[model samples]
Every structure is written in structure tokens, then in C-alpha cells.
Target: MSHASTAVQERPTPPGGPGAPESGLSSRSLPRLAPVGFAAVAIVLAVGLGLAAGWHSKVQWGMIAALFFLAISYAVTSVVENRRQAKDRLATSIVWVCFLIAVIPLVSLLWTTVSRGAERLDGYFLTHSMAGVLGSEASGGVYHALIGTLEQVGIATVISAPLGLLTAVYLVEYGKGSLAKAVTFFVDVMTGIPSIVAGLFILSIMLIFEIQPSGLMGALALTILMMPVVVRSTEEMLKLVPNELREASLALGIPKWRTILKVVLPTAIGGITTGVMLAIARIAGETAPIILLVFGSQLINANPFSGAQSSLPFYIYEQYKIGEAASYDRAWAAALVLIAFVMILNLVARGIARWKAPKTGR
Candidate 1:
């Protein structure tokens, strides 16, 4: 045979072909041991610390340290084996840390409130309306303040909701030119305006009209304070509605107003509701405006339009200022109640958001 022909017949096959060698990794892959190893070490360390210091002492710091180690291990493994994994692992760790940091204070507040406030949260506290229960008789509830809070805040919500929603729609959907820009700029400015300033504005308005300090004045002040937040939140939520949905509606010969009402609003309704609830929560606990505008009344005031009223915030302040141990306890209890109410509002917002979320699967 010729040399060339023999050479061709003797040539080796490609690496991955019929008689080729396998690549670096095997077909049956072993699970990466880094995470497992890290977890094992973390458990052992945590257990040893708990045994030495008692579980209660180790609960907070020990767990936090273990989580940090686990995150570091994941990061190291990712850098060694997978480039994309590194970024994702790092981001996940950061997000978790952020969540934990946010949750810690809230949990602490709630736990403390529940622990300390239980004494004053009884039926007597709810029924007597703060009439004559004095000097640590252990019988006064927050009925009057609760009523005042509900009525004044209810009025404020009614007054602010439509105005804020319309303002947001105009800004996001129809706003244009210098006027719109000016309105948006001012709204942003108003968002940072001091709560006391809002009170002063309402107070000045009342003074001009010869109206005395009253619950109505307080509601008006709160409405002013809350309106900007509502507008900002609602505008952001409305802006999140996809432009494609608007175009699709327009293509179907829907009027702009109808499209906003039926299509856009409904699509972004979850976020809008959540934002509104959050805005409400933000203002409900405000003491500055309410205290400045409304005189605190021990008796329950059903009418926000007429006389002085006492909301939880004002009640807390009033009780705190009395300088008695009993009054101080009452103030703490009121604080607990206010915090609970805000938490309930947040929970409700979350529920509404979940319920109103667009169905992804039929």
C-alpha cells in the first residue's frame, strides 16, 4: 500500500467520537458538596454554641452568623464552578439579609406591644370610653379614643381618596406640558412637607373661616398630609400598567375614559389598593397634625364635624403627658393598639394584592 493511504487509515478518531475519550466531567454527576459541607458545619457550630450558652442565648446571634457563613460558602462555590451562579447567589443572600433586617424591628415592636399591652386591652378598656377610670383603677379602656380615631380617619379617607386618585390619574395618564410638570414637581415637594406644616395650613384655613380647633380641622389636616402620598403611590401603580394593554383597548374602539376605568385600573388595581392602604397606614399613626389641630376629649366624640376629638395618637400623647404611672401604662397600651392597627392594615393590603393579582394560569 502507498504511504499516504496507510497514513489516512491509521489516523486517530476525534475525542468524542466512536473510540474517543470522555470529557473532564462524568455522565453521572455527583452533587456539589460545598453547600452540604457548609450546612453540616453550620449545624455543628450552632449546636455547640447552643449547648454552651443555652438555646435562647444562641437563637439570634448564632443563627445570624450561620446564615452569613452559608452565604459565603455559596459565593465561594459559585466563583469556582459557575460564573452566573456567583451573581445570583450573592443577590439572594443580600435580599435575605435585607428582609431579615427589615423584619427584626417590626417583630420586636409587635412582640413587645403584645406582651406589655395585654393588661390594658381587656373588655373594660373597650366598653367604658375613658370616662371615670382613673389612678390605676385597672378598668379604663380606649373606647373613646378608638371612636375618635375611626370617625376622624374615616372622614379623612373619604375626603382624600377620590381627590388623590383623580390627581394621580391626571398626572400619569393625561398630564402634559409645563402645567403637568409643575403639578408633578409640586406633588413631589409636598411629599416631604412636614406633618406640622400640614396642620398649620389647616389651622390657618380654619382661622380664616373663624372655625375653632376641632376633629374636622384635624381630619382636614390629615387629608392634606395624606393626599400627596396617595397621589404618588397611585400614580406609580397606574404607571405600572402595561402600555400594550392600553393600545389593545384603544384598538378595540374603547374610549379613553372607559379604557382607564375598565382596563387599566382593574389591571393595576392590586397595586393601587396596596398603595392606598399603605398611605392610610402611614398617616393613621401621625401625632403631629392631629395633636396640633384637634383637642383631646375624654368622652367619645362621634361627630368629626363639630367638636374636639381624640384619636389613638392624640390619646397616647394626652395620657403620656399626665405624668402618672397609670397614665403612662395607658399610653403604652394605646401605642400598642395603634401599632396593631397599622399591622392589620398592612396585612389587609397584602391580602388585597394577592387576591387581585392577575390570574396567570387558567
Candidate 2:
């Protein structure tokens, strides 16, 4: 043979005959059924162990299954592929496990509420009040509590929204020196103040002035609790509004206050509205303030500024306290109503967000 042919013959074959590693690392991958198979095995093992050990808690069994799934997945992936791919799979598995863990409680709570509360939820339940119904009877409705919640939350929103928005604007646009820092610090501190503490603060003021318990007092306490949340959310939203928008407005000979009112506020309006709604929802379900300030009543009191009022949360608490079957049913129904109210508010907020979002195409 010629010299070129001899050289070609002398050259050794590539690791796997051609264009491949000898260890087959590049070609290796976990089988498509790996996750499902591992999960099934883990579940079976966990169930068997739980039964053998006489553990009745499904939570414990679930934890064991999750742990087993993670371990078996990592081991199999590491053996079939490599350490790097194994770690990736392990992280993904961990994320899924955590998601399930977080979602389980929420699902359970919703299911329990819906199942137990649907029995008493009807037209009469939504329209009438608990004015003359006994706790042991199932004739009362949540209309009074609903009215109280709406009025109190509305008043609190009206008070907090403007204050929170203006405060946020100041912090973002013009605040400086010690005053700004002090405001920010206090706002942070107020964010963590308990609902009962807010109620107590308002109650103290009421006591000094010899004021009576009423829905207005509850609204005041709610305002104190809600302002910080609004401030924080609005401040963050304002921060997210690009500096370019403000600069462009200023470049057009606009005054600072006018620019803020005309440009900045409109730009962040969706987020501000959503924040205000969330704050309203939060205060709507507070029982402590209602109990302390409004002094829950069975009769409907349309005037928030004068007499004792009934709120959904306080009504739920009062009914549950009775510890009778009928009372329990009312409590669950009221809870379901509160949840639905909050959900509606959230849905409205999202709708507002979509509606007010800046038009990009036009």
C-alpha cells in the first residue's frame, strides 16, 4: 500500500468508532417514564411504611413519599447520566415538591369551606339579617355583616388611598433628609403592628373621648392597619415607573406637582388601585377591630357613625363561639361569604390592571 493508505490504517478508531465518548456520557439520558415510575414506587413504599408504623397522618406519609422520590430520582439520574444532570433533576424535583406542599393546605381549606358552607348559602342567606334569629336556629343571614363590612372597608379605603398615594409620591419624588427617613421607618414599623394593637390604639382614643363603639371606630382602626400596606405597595409601584417618564414631562415645562399628578399618578394608577383593593380586602376580614371597636351586634345598624355594627368576621366568631350545630353552619357560611368577597375584590383588581395597562400597540 502507498504511504497515505498506511497512515490511515495506522490511525486508531475514535473512542466509540466515530464522534463519540468512550463512556457514552453525551448519549445518556433518563428514561421518559423515570419520574412517574419513581414517584409510584416512592408512594407505595411510603404507604407501606406508614401502615406498618401505625402512623395515621397523611401529611407524614406525603412527606415520606416526597423524600423517597427525591432520593430515588437523584440516585437513578446520577447512575444513568452524570452528577450535573442528577443535580438539575434533583432541584426540579425539589421545586415540584415544594409547590405541592404549599398548595395542599390551600386546596384543603377551600374544599372544606365549600363543602360545609354550601348547605346554608342561598337567596335568603344573602338578603336577610340576623336581627331576630337565635344562635341555635338556622334562620339568620349575613346581610347585616356584609353591609357593615362594605361600609367600613369603603370608609377605610377612602381614608387610606389618598394618604398612602401622596405619601408614596413624596418619598419617591420630593422627600429628603430626616423627615423622609422617619416616615419610612414609621411606615415599616406600622406594617408589622398587629390588628388587635391597631384596634387597641383606636380604642384608647375612644376611651379618652368617651366615644361609643360603632362601625366608624372599626373603620378608623382598619385605616391604621391598612395605610402601611398601601404606602408600601404604592411606593414600590411608583419606584417601578421609569424615571424617563418624569424627565420627559419635566422637559415639557411641567411643574413638579403637575407632573406628578398628571404623569406619575396615571402611570401607576393600576397598581395603586390594586393595592388599595387588597388593603380593603385585608381589613374586611379583621375580627379583632370589629370586636373591639364595632362591638358586634345581631341587629342591622345602617349608620356606621352611630351604633354598634356587625361585620362578617365578627359574626363568624360569634356564631362559632356558640358551639352548636346551627351556629357552626352559620360560621362556615359566613366564612365562605368572606372568602368570596375577597376573591371578588381580587378579580376586580386584576380586571382594573388589565384595563388600565398602558396601550402598547397604539
Best-matching candidate per TM-score: 2
Give the best candidate by lDDT.
Answer: 2
Clashing pairs in 1: 125-141
For candidate 1, write residues 1-362 as lDDT tens digits.
69999999899876545563332222332256655565567667667666776666645654755675556666574545443555555566567667766888789878887787776776777666677667455557688888888877878889888999999999989999999999899989989998999998987888899897778888888888888888999999998899999999999999999999998888888888888888788788888988878878878778878888888998888887878878877888888888878878889888988898778798
TM-score of 1: 0.76
**Deviating ranges (above 4 Å) for candidate 2:** 1-25, 31-33
TM-score for candidate 2: 0.92
Clashes per candidate, residues 3 or more apart or on different chains: 1, 0
* Residue-level error in angstroms, candidate 1, position 316: 1.8
TM-scores of the models, in the given order?
0.76, 0.92
lDDT tens digits, residue span 272-353, model 2 = 8899888888888889989999998888889999999999999999999999999999899999999999999999998988
Question: Where's the lowest-lDDT run of ten residues in candidate 2?
Answer: 17-26
